[model samples]
Target: MNSNWFKLLMKATRVQYGENLKLNGVPVVFNKQGAELLIGDNVTINSSFLSNLVGLYQRTIIVTRTHDSKIAIGNNVGISGATIYARTSITIGENTLIGGNSKIMDNDFHPIEVEARNTDIKEKIAARPIVIGKNCFIGCNSLILKGTILGEGCVVGAGAVVSGVFEDNCVIAGNPAKVIKRL
Candidate 1:
């Protein structure tokens, strides 16, 4: 196949693609640059099989968020149709499987009050960092908001909106997501 198409993909990897980098027929687009996007070895960031981590740019450059950001995906990760719109930093740990159409953000992007949102206040909230631990499985259509951390082995149910820190191996769901059960 054409490995030239993967040069951009290779540059997108964190740790300078480390020892081994694997992308399987994936369509990837970057909104901005001067930031590192780290994807580890044996990780399939495939857009053909499942479209995850594919940035939208309307054939030009689809940006989910307007700020330059850092997105780090660790080893053995499987992301399928996940949208991460970050103005700051987003780190996902090893062996995590992010589901289809899930939107994750590291910043609030806007203030609670309408007036504050009109100015630069939202930018303050948008600069915070987000981290997800090892072996977590986030469900389809889930929205993980800014400043939220999911501990190891967290399973977020479909269509859930999550904020704040959640316990490891717990099943969380619903709006403003809560722990439903522990796995």
Candidate 2:
């Protein structure tokens, strides 16, 4: 899709974006009423399969699920077919790279307790805020769960499941992400 048209769509959803926003393909962005989705200058989002060499599994999905939720992406960030869903809040700092097929969510989306799953879905949902600091690189297929805070210049390895507070300049990897190296 044309970048101009995409920008119009973003405007229609009340998503505030800065200059030089490049859209390789039209992304799926849904900013709920009374929610905020802010994108900074020089951002590049690749949604088409061939746009990123890493190969996207699907179009990029950016959603603010609740009225008070927010998703803020800083300047010079690159996203490739990732799913960034926020029930509360999510902030990605400047110059960060969210690799292909990655999932960054600030909510569990459903109740963990079996009884609450059907009876009290909204009230029992678990959610927290996610903060990815400046110049961080989240590798392909990574799952950044609720309450995760990554400090500046951190690098997450592909396929890692990250769900904790990681300090600055850490090289993280594995199922439950560990600090493999400090950069």
Candidate 3:
């Protein structure tokens, strides 16, 4: 199939998308009932797998499992090969850049306790909101977990696993990421 046709088919699947939502490329967006996926204008998504092209296990997957779940992406943002799953809410502000193979999620998917884990995957799920503020840069192979509030202009280094509330204009890196520098 043609690229444009593929994009049009994908666009038909989104719950809500704003002006110029496909400025760069198409993104795979999935929303269940009571779930809302909002995308603002002039968003650039260069996720190869999302476009029905041959990619190396890469795709832009956005899923809101529950009815109350939401995934809101602001204008002028660029995302590549990212996976964003929301059980509550996941908001990415304007002018943010997300590198390839990155993940931003608002739910733990399972409990920490062995018994609870053995019981069910959603038994002890701790879902929270994830907010990535404006002008942020998230490097490749990063993980932005539940309850993470990245302030404006923050930078998350590659291969970092981040959580918690971080102030504006700083660099966060490492596993269980910490502020490495102030920018």
Q: Which candidate has the top score in TM-score?
A: 2
Global lDDT of model 3: 0.83
Off by over 4 Å in 3: 1-14, 23-26, 49-56, 121-123
lDDT scores of the candidates, listed in order: 0.68, 0.96, 0.83
Query: How many clashing pairs in candidate 3?
Result: 1
Q: Could you give candidate 2's per-residue lDDT for residues 31-114 as a string of tens digits?
A: 999999999999999999999988899999999999999999999999999999999999999999999999999999889999
Candidate 2 clashing pairs, residues 3+ apart or interchain: none
Q: Which scores greater on lDDT, model 1 or model 2?
A: 2
Candidate 3 residue lDDT tens string, 49-104? 54423241476778888888999999998888789999999999999988887899
Superposed Cα deviation of residue 2, candidate 2 (Å): 2.4
Error of 1 at 124 (Å): 4.7
Candidate 2: Cα lDDT at 123: 67
C-alpha RMSD for every candidate:
4.6, 0.8, 3.2
How many pairs collide in each candidate, listed in order? Answer: 7, 0, 1
Better of 2 and 3 by TM-score: 2
lDDT of 3 at 183: 96
RMSD from true fold, candidate 2: 0.8
